[model samples]
Target: MKIGELANRSGLTPSRIRFYERIGLLKAVDRKANGYRSYPAEAVTILGLIALAQGAGFSLDEIRALLPADLEHWEHDALAGALTRKVADIETLQARLARSKAHLLHVIDEIEARPDDIDCATNARRVLTRLLGEDAEMPVASLRAKQF
Candidate 1:
């Protein structure tokens, strides 16, 4: 098939297909006498795999490393290792994000729990003291000047 047909089948733009070819993600194409790029039937499947891998958070370089020049000779061990590492990286990111979310929620709770009589500066100081240690003394004037 031609480049247009391949792009249509793969659900990618012509520019994207060309980009993949330039970046060495897609293998070289055969050119017809009229200078039209010719692609094999397997090109559509490869493009779909590239799109899927990108959606799964794999970078183009990472995808390139995962895929071989010849689709028939895939490196199973390397692919498995890359998948394991990506999962571990995602888990670590999730843990960090959870911690950040918890900290934000705690801060929100502290702000909401402030007494009616307490001023904004005093509440800010109290919240800051709770977040940081009691040893960290921030001036009420500075706290009042800053927005949340």
Candidate 2:
């Protein structure tokens, strides 16, 4: 099929497909006598795999290294190792995100726990102190005057 038909079948824009070709992610396509790009039926499957890898956070360079021009020649051990490493990276990111979420919730709890009798400025100062620690170099008085 031609580039347009390939793009339509693959659910990617023609320019994107051309960009992939330029970046060496997609192998060189055959050209017809009329100078139109010719793509094999397997191109659609390859494009789908590329999209899946990108959605899973693999960079184009990584995908290029992981995927061979011909799927039949894929190295099973290398592919498995790369997938395992990606899973570990994702797990580490999840842990960091969890910590960030917990810290945000702690900050919210501290800010919301202010006594009703305390003024906003004093409450802000108290929250800032708890957040920054008592020995923080930044002045709490100035921070309290600024809106959150």
Candidate 3:
């Protein structure tokens, strides 16, 4: 089919499909006598897989490396290894995100624990001390300068 029909069937924009072709990801394309792009039926399936792989955190380069030259043939060991590595990367990211979330919660708790007796400046200092330990002793002017 033509680019428009392929885009409609694949749920991808024509520009995006052209971009994939430019980047050497979508290879099953031909130019007809009328100088329009023609795509095989398999292009739709390939585009779908590309979208799914991107959603699953596969970079375009990674997807290109993983895609088989022939659809019917895949290097099973390579595919399995790449997937295992991606899982490990995701687990590491999850651990880091959990740590960041815990730190943010701790900061929120400190900010919310302000005593009525203390002024805003004092409460801010107190929260900063709890959050930053020894580093919180730096003068506010110096902290402001460092931020810039």
Which candidate number has the best lDDT? 3
What are the per-model C-alpha RMSD values against the true structure?
Answer: 4.9, 4.7, 3.8
Arrange candidates, best TM-score first.
Answer: 3, 2, 1
lDDT per residue for candidate 1 within 74-114, as digits (tens), equals 99999999999989989998997898788789999999999
Per-model TM values vs. the true structure: 0.82, 0.86, 0.88
Query: Global lDDT for candidate 2?
Result: 0.86
The CA lDDT at 64 in model 3 is 98
Question: Between which residue pairs do clashes occur in model 3?
Answer: none
Evaluate model 2: give its TM-score.
Answer: 0.86
Candidate 3 wrongly placed segments (more than 4 Å): 137-148
lDDT of each: 0.87, 0.86, 0.88
**What would the per-residue lDDT of candidate 2 be over residues 9-127, giving only the tens digit for each residue?**
99999999999988988884897888889888888988999999999988988899998769789989989999999999999989978987997898889989999999989998898
Ranking by lDDT: 3, 1, 2
Q: Model 2: how far is 16 from its true place, Å?
A: 0.7
